[model samples]
Target chain A: MKIAIASGKGGTGKTTLSTNLASFLAEEHEVVLTDLDVEEPNSGLFIEADLVREKDKFKMVPEWSADECILCGNCQKVCNFHAVIQLGEMIMVFPELCHGCYACSELCPTSSLPMIPKKMGVLKHFRNGNLNFVESRLDIGEEQAVPLIKQTHKYIDQQFDDNFIRIFDSPPGTSCPVIEATKDADYIILVTEPTPFGLHDLKLAVETMKELKKEFGVVINRFGIGNDDVLAYCNEEQIKVLAKIPNSRRIAELYSQGRLIYKEIPEVRAELEKMKDLIMGKMKEVVK
Target chain B: MKIAFTTKGTNWSSAMDPRFGRTEYFLIYDDEKDELSHYDNRDSANDAHGAGPKTAQKLFEFSPNILITGNGPGGNAATVLEKTGVKIFIGAGEMTVKEAYEAFKGDTLKKL
Candidate 1:
C-alpha cells in the first residue's frame, strides 16, 4: 500500500516521521521511500542510499519563431499566462511565465510558436539495503514545484511493484505541491504537534483530506509537550490517532544529528511498527 | 499622442493608482481629440497570474504613446511596453491622474 506522511506546518516532524517509519518498515517489507518535497528534500539526509539513477524533469514552454514573420498578436491574445507578447515587429516569449499549455501555439495562425522543453528539475533514484529511495530536486529559481512532484509520482508509478510498500514524504502545508504529492496515496499520515499552531494547521490539512476524500490518520509528534486539544479535536472529527512519539531530548538530539530515532530508540521503533500494522489494517478495511 | 494613467476612478480627478497591474482602471487621454476615456482593469486586477503582462496587453489596445503611473510596470509588462514604443513615466504618488499628466507634460515625472 502507498502511504504519504504530510503536515500543514513546516518543521512539524514530517521528514522525521517519514524517514523513521520507512526505515522501520523496511526491516520486514520491500519498501520504496519517495521524498516528494522537491523544493527541499531532506528525508534523503537521514537515510543512507546509493544513487543508482538520475533523470532530468522537463516542462514544455513556448518558443517564438520571429522568422515566421507574423506579428498578428494572436499568440499573445490566446495566452492566459501572458507569456507571449507582440511589440510591433518583435514577438517576445517569456518561458518563465509559460504554463506549458500550448494555447498560444494552438491559436497562432501562422504557427510561429513551437513548444520547447525547459529543464525544471532532476529526479534521483537510490538504493539502500532493502529500501529504494527516490527524490526530486528542483532547479534553482524554478517557481513551480507541482510539476516536479508530478514527475516524481509518474516515476514511482512506472517502477512501482505491488509487493513493495510505498512511502511518500510530502511537502508541508495544504497547498498545490502537498496535494500533488499525496493525492494518489492509499493512505495519508498527517504528522503534527499538539500546539495551537499545529492544531490550527492540522484542521486545515484535515479539511483538505476530506475534500480529496482520502482516508487519513494523525500522528502526534512531541506528544508530551502540549495539551490534549489535538486529540480531542481528532476524536470529535472521527479521525484516528495512529501513533504518538513523546517529546524527548534524545529523539530531538538524534534528529538534529541527522539520525533516525527508530534505529536508536526501541520505543519509537515499536510505535512505528504499530503504525505500519494499523495502516495495513486500514488498507485491508478499504479493500473490503 | 495618447496618454494612459493607472487610476482608481474613471475621471482625471481620480488618484493615480500605485500598482500598474492591479489598478482598478486606466484613464486614457487623447491629445489630438482632447477627450478622456477609461477601461475597467478589474479583470487584470483579479487575474491569478500574469496580471502585469495582461494589463499591458489591455492598455496596448488604446495605442498610448506614454504611460503615467505611481510606480513603474513589472518586468514582463515593461518589456512589452518598451518594445511597443510606449514611454513609461513613474513617481506620480498621491497625485491625481490630471496632475500626473500635467507633471508628465512639464517633464517633471521620472521617466522609467
Candidate 2:
C-alpha cells in the first residue's frame, strides 16, 4: 500500500511516525520510507541505513552567448520568475530566483538562447535491513522545494513494485511542496497534535486533501496536553481518528536521543500494527 | 534645467533621485542653479512592469538634465536614452520631489 504520513504543523512527530511504521513493516514485508521533507530530512539520523545512491537535482538557468548578437529583450519578457534581466548588449541570469522551468530559453525569440543545468538539490538513498530510506536536501538559499519533491517521487515510482509497502513522510503545511508530495497516494495519514494551532492548520490540510479526492485518517499526537478541539473537529467533519498517542516525555526524550518510539515503547508497535490494519481496512473500502 | 525621474519600482530609479520610485511624486531638480520642480504621478500609473523602459522614455520627454532611478542603464532602455546624453543616476532612495531638488541644488546628494 502506498501510504503518505503528513502533518499540518512541524514537530508533531510525523517523522517519528513514518520511520517507525517503515521499520516495523520492513520486519516482515518490503517497505520504503521516503523523507519528502527536503528542507531538513531527519529520517536518516535515526534509521541506520547504509548509503547506496546519491542523485543531484538540476534546475534550468539561462546561458547567454555574446557571439550571436542581437540585444533583443524577448527573454526578459517571457521570464515570469524574474530571473533574467536584459542589459544593453548584455543579458544576465539570476540563478537564485530561477525555478528551473526552462520557459525563458524555450520562448527566447533569438534561437541563440542556451539552457544550462544548475544543481538545485541532492537526493540520497540508504538501506537498512529490509527498509529503504530515501531523503532529499535542497541547496542552501534555494526557494522552491517542489522540484526536489517531484524528482524524489519520480525516483520512488521507478523503483516501486506492486509488493512493497511504500510510506512517504511528507513536509508540513498545505503548500505547493506538500501538495506535490501527497498526490496519488493510496492512503494518507494526517498526523496532527491537539493544539489550537494544530487544529486550525488541520482544517486547511483536511480541506486540501478532500479536494484532492484522497482517503485520509487523522492521528492525534500529544492528545492529553491540548484541548479536545481536534477530536471535535474530526467528529464534526466525520473524519476518522485512526489513533491517539498521548503526551509522553519518554517518547520525546527517546526521540531526542535519536531512538524510535517503538524501540522505547515496544508496545506502541502493537498500536501501529493495529493502526495499519485500520488503514488497510479503509483501503479495502476505497478499492471497493 | 529640469531633471526627470523615472516613476518605476527599482534601485536604479532611486539611485539617481529620491522621488524616482516613490508613488504620487516626481523629482525635478537643477543641480548647478539649485532649482526644483515636483509633479505627482497622477498622470503615470503603468510604470512597474517592463523594467521602466517605457516610463524612462516618458520621463525623457520632460527634458531633464539628469535621470535618477534604482536600476542602471545596461539594457535597451539605456540605448534608447543614450541619445539624449542625459546624466543617469542609479540607486536613488525615497527623497521627496522637492527634497531631491533641494539636495541637487545644495550639491549635498551623493551618487549611489
Superposed by TM-score, candidate 1 places the C-alpha of residue A65 at a distance from the truth, in angstroms, of 2.9
Q: Compared with the true structure, what per-residue lDDT tens digits does model 1 show for residues A208-249?
A: 999999999999999998899999999998999999998999
Please name the candidate that would achieve the greatest lDDT relative to the true structure: 1
**Cα misplacement distance, residue A281 of candidate 2 (Å):** 3.7
TM-score of chain A of each: 0.94, 0.93
Interface RMSD values for the candidates, listed in order? 1.5, 7.1
Per residue, candidate 2 scores C-alpha lDDT tens digits across A1-288 of 679888788888899889888898888778899999998888887798899899888877778877874877787677765466664566666665666777777876666668888898999989987898899999997767888898898999898775678889999988888899899698899999999989988998898899889889999888798898999999999999988876888988988888888866866776788887875565466555
Q: lDDT value for candidate 2?
A: 0.74
Question: What DockQ does candidate 1 score?
Answer: 0.54
Q: How close is candidate 2 to the true structure, as a TM-score?
A: 0.76
Candidate 1 residue lDDT tens string, B1-112: 8999999999978988989888989999998999999999887755666888778877887889888998788877887777678888899968998899889989999988
Note the B-chain TM-score for every model.
0.95, 0.52
Q: Which lDDT value does model 2 have at A163?
A: 68
